[model samples]
Target: MKAAIIGGGVIGGGWAARFLLNGWDVAVFDPDPEAERKIGEVIANARRSLPALYDTALPAEGNLSFHSEMADAVQNANWIQESIPERLDLKHRILGDLSELAPETAVIGSSTSGFKPSELNEKGARAIVAHPFNPVYLLPLIELVGDAGACENAAPVLRSIGMFPLMVRKEIDAHIADRFLEAVWREALWLVKDGIATTEEIDEAIRMGFGIRWAQMGLFETYRIAGGEAGMKHFMAQFGPALKWPWTKLMDVPEFTDELVDLIAGQSDAQSGHMSIRELERLRDDNLVGMMRALKKTGSGAGGVIQRHEADLPKPEAPDLPITGDRKIPVSWTDYNGHMNETHYLEAGSLATDRFMELIGADANYIASGKSYFTIETHVRYLSELHAGNRLTIRTQVLKGEGKKLHLFHFLYGPDDTLAATVETLLLHVDLTTRASSLPDQAVAEKLGAYHQAHAALEQPEGAGRSVGQKA
Candidate 1:
């Protein structure tokens, strides 16, 4: 698919990175001469962080081009995103032009934070509010508000690129999330202006407190837990009355005076001026990846979004042995030596074994039927070092497969196509309830037999069945 980015500032660059990293060819039309450099930096950050969020590799990055003319950028584009400044007249003019030039089937998404779709389309344009948070590649939520048909068309496309399309039920100012954000933003400004909390203190209060809760459960769910066995109704009865109290200046707006700007900016500089913006972005991305990965375990919030999207990613295919595992080495998998930790090699092998099991019908359903393969033994031979970001591919060969026993050989190849590692494993079919060895199901046995026969013709993999410290 092709995406046209009508602007290439921070948000525009982020949209481009999100589309491009997901294997969509991106054409960017930004008048700024430095747009390419700026977007390249954003993509560089995305390339490091986005792939780390997944256990499997993302699709190969698509082509990127810079166009001087808007018409050239939108040519044959499937999605056209406008990320120009937030002026209504400017958006109207640009979106109007885009609707005329873009393909009839194209979906035009405006990255407007505050404007409603009705206002955007008033100038005879077909545009939807596709507001995404900063670092759009990693953040999954895209608030979509517009024509029902357009939103329906965009939702699947957004999902394909690993985004969560939240369809707004009605046209409202600032859509959904931003409305809540603006509320908190207003309160925070008041706190800063009224000598209550410094910028860093407020940030610490959030990152060290409710921000973590909000990341996983959001408002109502977390409060439900706080209800202490009585749930939301009881908690609301107790604390809902506090809503009338003047605990927050949520409805008040802090004047944007020069002194206030200087106070906040100066305090912020003191708190984090040592690091560059890129450094801060990297730190933020790393933290988000770690948090999101943790959430994946429980299918919480953005983590659940990632899990669903990963299920749809294409499985790798090989002509001989199947490509059971294909992914980039995330930074978290590394050790003090700046290379992939040894434990992860075994983890990768285990994942490959799981995939191989699924290939032969020993999948979730079969396991749920009280029959599954349990690894009895494993031997790993490390041939080369793997560093973070190196792509790893595991090809499996079914060495022996029979009624109750299974033997497999896995070849782990690094980015250079060199032999990085080898894992030899043995597993036995078992009844989960009894925890005892059992005969494989007839269907599973037949599938395994076919692979075993096909692999019989190939030469014995080197170092297979080798004992520890043995000579080659």
Candidate 2:
């Protein structure tokens, strides 16, 4: 797929890096003379952060081209993302031009804060408001509002690049998030205006406590959990009365006078005196990636989404026998015969099968407690000689999995789909402590059964393991 990003500053470049790294060609448009340098910085950071989110290798980077003309950037684009300045008239002009040059099949998204879709469509051209945060590649929440069709149309494409599109129920100023942010900003201003805490101190308060929880589970949900064993109602009954406290004026707005702005600027500068903005941004990105990956361990909402996205992400095809890491036959695997050792061929095949099993949720944890499939019998037929680094893959199929036993068949193939060997194994579930034949746990049985059921329709291999009850 191809994506076009307008306004080639930090956000635009982040989007470009994200799409390009994920195998989408990206074209960028920005009139600024410094676009190349600015975008390069963002891409540099993205290159480090995005890949750090995954363990497997990614597809090769896609092509990226800069365009001075908006039309040139958007030509033949499946998606057009606008990240220009937040001025309304500027957006209207760009939207009008995009609507004219881009095809209807292309989804147009705008990164606008506080501008309603209604306001943004003043020229009678509809575009979705897709307000992605700065460092657009890292933080995945995109506020989407416009034609319902537009949101539905763009959600999957947004998801493809590892973003979550959140749709607002109705068009409102600043959309859903900024309202919360504005509230906090107002309160923080009041605090700073009275010198209650410094800018850095406020940030410290957030990062040390609720900020961590909010990363995995957002505010309201966490509060709901805090409501206790009885849930929301119980918590509300216990603490909702604090809402009427005379000590606080909840809705008062402090004036954004010059004094306040200067104070904030001075304090923030002092707080971040050590790091340049670019350095700080890189720091933020590194931290976000770490937190998100840690969250994925728990299968939290966003973490689970990333986990699923990574799951569906395609692994590169392995090169032809002895399929190992990076599709390159390792030097150590070579033997005195100059071909890979025979045992290592089986070892490689086992490794490939093991990797495949882990992909489907079987791993050491599932096997360590003596709840593993023990091979009861095996038949391997070598059809062709394999030299060192001669490529190989195993095409495997389940022959039978009924009650307590399973039958599996594998065909080892080399380059040009040449058949090199075949393996068949009959397996039994056993308890590790007693080493006795045993029935699989219900969950294990169900998983095996599901796999067996899914592959039940395949044709039988040329040779299969003999049943214990039937003689050859």
Candidate 3:
């Protein structure tokens, strides 16, 4: 598929990166002379961060081109995303031009924070408000507003690019998330104006407090959990009355005087001015990757979306070798030495074992039937250091596969084709409920025996039989 981005600002570049990295050819039209440089920078950041969120490799990136004319950009586009500034007139003009050239089936999405669909559709254009948060390549939530059919048509396409599309039932000013964000912005401004907190203090309050909760559990669910056994009703009944208090200036406004602006800017500068914007962006991406990976482990919220998507990702093709894993080392797996931690070797081995189990017919369906392989013993030899961001693969050999016992040997090779680590594992087929070893089914046994026989002639690796002791 081909995507055309009508602007090349931060949000627009992000859209380009998201679609381009997902294997969609992208054409971006922006009048700015520096649009290409800026969009290239955003794509570099996206390349580093977005793919780190998953264990499997993303599809081969699509082609990217910059165009000066709107007609040239949207000529063969399947989706046209308009992320010009917030001005409605400019958006209407761009959409008018886009609608004229774009394919009839093309979905036109406007990244307007405050405008409703009706407001944007005034000139008989069928543009939809497909508002996405900043760093669009990473964040999954997108608020979509438009005709039901248009929104519905865009939903799967958005999801196909690893986005969560929230189609608004009714259009309102600022949509949903931005409305909540606007409320917080107003309150934070009031706090700064009232001398209650500095910019850094307010940021710390959010990051150290509810911000983490909001990532996995949104406002209502977090409050529901806080309500104990009674849930949301009890929590609302207890705290809803506090809404009448003057604790927040939700309805009030703060003057955007030069003095106020300088004060906030000065505080922000003092807080995080040391790092360059690129450095800060990398920091933010690293944190997001870590947090998202944790959420993936638990299968909740945005992390759950990533986990499900990763499961559907196609496994990398292997040659004649019995390949178990083909993925990059996530930054979260690195230790203080700037290389992969010792524990992660075992983690990688465990994942390889999972793949091996699937190869032998002990898949999800089999495991769900109360039978699965349980690793009883594992020994890992770390031959060399493997750093974060390194693409690696695990090669496996079945040493024994009979009765209820399975012995496997795995070799982990780093980016340079050097063996970074080796793992030897012993597993037992067991009934999960009984926790006792059990005979493998005939089909599973046959597959395992085939692998064992195929690998029988291979010589043992150097560290295969070593024990933890000094030679006398």
The lDDT per prediction is 0.93, 0.76, 0.90
Q: List the residue pairs that clash in candidate 1.
A: none
TM-score of each: 0.97, 0.73, 0.95
Counted clashes in each candidate structure: 0, 6, 0
**Runs with alpha carbons beyond 4 Å of true place in candidate 1:** none
Q: Output the better candidate (1/2) by lDDT.
A: 1
RMSD (Å) of each candidate, 1 decimal: 1.4, 10.4, 1.9
lDDT of 2 by residue, 1-472 (tens): 8999998877788888888878899999999999988998888777767765654435667898999888999999999988889899999999989999997799988888889989989897668898887778777788999889889999998888788889888999999988888888878888888999999999999999998988888987998899888898888899888888764444898887998899999999889988998889877876877787777778786677677677667654332212222232433445787766667566655655555444334456777766666777776666676663344556566667667787767677776778877777777767778888788777767766766786687666765654434544
Q: How far is 185's C-alpha from truth in model 3 (Å)?
A: 0.4
Which runs in model 3 stand beyond 4 Å of their true positions?
A: 468-472
Candidate maximizing lDDT: 1
Backbone clashes in model 3, listed as residue pairs:
none
Model 1 collision count: 0
Q: By TM-score, highest first, what's the ranking?
A: 1, 3, 2
- lDDT-wise, the better of 2 and 3 is 3
